[model samples]
Target: SAEGEELLRKLPGYLAQPGVTALVFNFVDQLIHGRSEHAILHEVARDASALRSLTRTWFEESALMRALREAERRSVPVLLTTDHGSIHCNTPATVFAKRDATANLRYKFGEDLRAERPDTALLVDDLPSWGLPQMHLGVRLLLALSDHFFVYPTKLREYQGRYRGAFLHGGVTPEEMIVPVALLTPRSAG
Candidate 1:
């Protein structure tokens, strides 16, 4: 713990670097690993209240508070945002795709991607129209809808056992699509 605190103490200096237009720190790993797994396996609450409690503890214990304190002391502006949010996916939708298809639990993009349960996924054949760059011809995107994750029939049971109730993004659900963005001005600057 002392080592961790020592590492975090350097955050202020890192943020104060000269000519640095912006600096970013990624704490998503802390959010992702073991959060849903523990919640699902231990039958803890998986609702927003639980998330708020967990994140509250994390912010208090982690470097976020220190970062905020440094920013305020230096009168720096802070921008908080997430590329996407995650959802607790319960259902596994069987999908068939080429061997080289990208293997994300929540979505897949490749040629000839098809879900056995069509209702569980939203098929987007027009990648360009969706603001996704077309890597090649026939590069369709399949986004698992609601709380479903794409799984291969060959390893359906294994995937279900491992990923059931896991929090994942890259889907077509509101939880994944609607993310938060906040611009914070330090009180001294404000």
Candidate 2:
């Protein structure tokens, strides 16, 4: 990571600047990679502990932590949040769609989208009621339900083998909906 360390070193300069500053750190890649590896090798359900441990380790060893300390030293109020959370998708649901459909496994929107197992998905034909813009006529939203991940029928076996236990988002599960928001103030500021 020495190659990438310099990029994060710039954080301090940004933090030192006057006016409201917003810092964003992306820990999703590591979480997803770790979870996918575990799912591929282990039969145990996607373990939250593994992700928690990974996050803790990343915070302790990464330059971001030093930046946090720097912010604290400067008495900079910190607000940390995530746009969305992820869920372990173990159920593979078959979906039929045209070649132009979106490829994301968690959700898809296209002129033609239908789940082979209707119970495993939620289909919304009324896009406007949901506040989603109607990109085109007859466009519908199909969301995988519970722990299900969508896989095209043409390559069901291939996709299932690769993404059966992967961590994915864009679903309606509690894990995907609920995220943490932390507001931290330095002791010196108080």
Provide the TM-score for each candidate, comma-separated.
0.81, 0.86
lDDT of 1 by residue, 80-173 (tens): 7777888888899999998868989888988889999899999999888888887888778889999998899999999898888677888989
After superposition, the stretches of candidate 2 with alpha carbons farther than 4 Å from their true spots are 2-4, 33-46
In model 1, which range of ten residues has the least summed lDDT? 39-48
In angstroms, how far off is 152's CA in candidate 1? Answer: 1.1
Candidate 1 runs further than 4 Å off: 1-21, 34-48
Error of 1 at 121 (Å): 1.1
Q: What is the C-alpha local distance difference test score of candidate 1?
A: 0.78
Q: Deviation in angstroms for 158 in model 1?
A: 1.3
Cα shift from native, residue 138, model 2 (Å): 1.4
Please give the lDDT score for candidate 2. Answer: 0.80
Q: Lowest-lDDT window of 10 residues in candidate 2?
A: 37-46
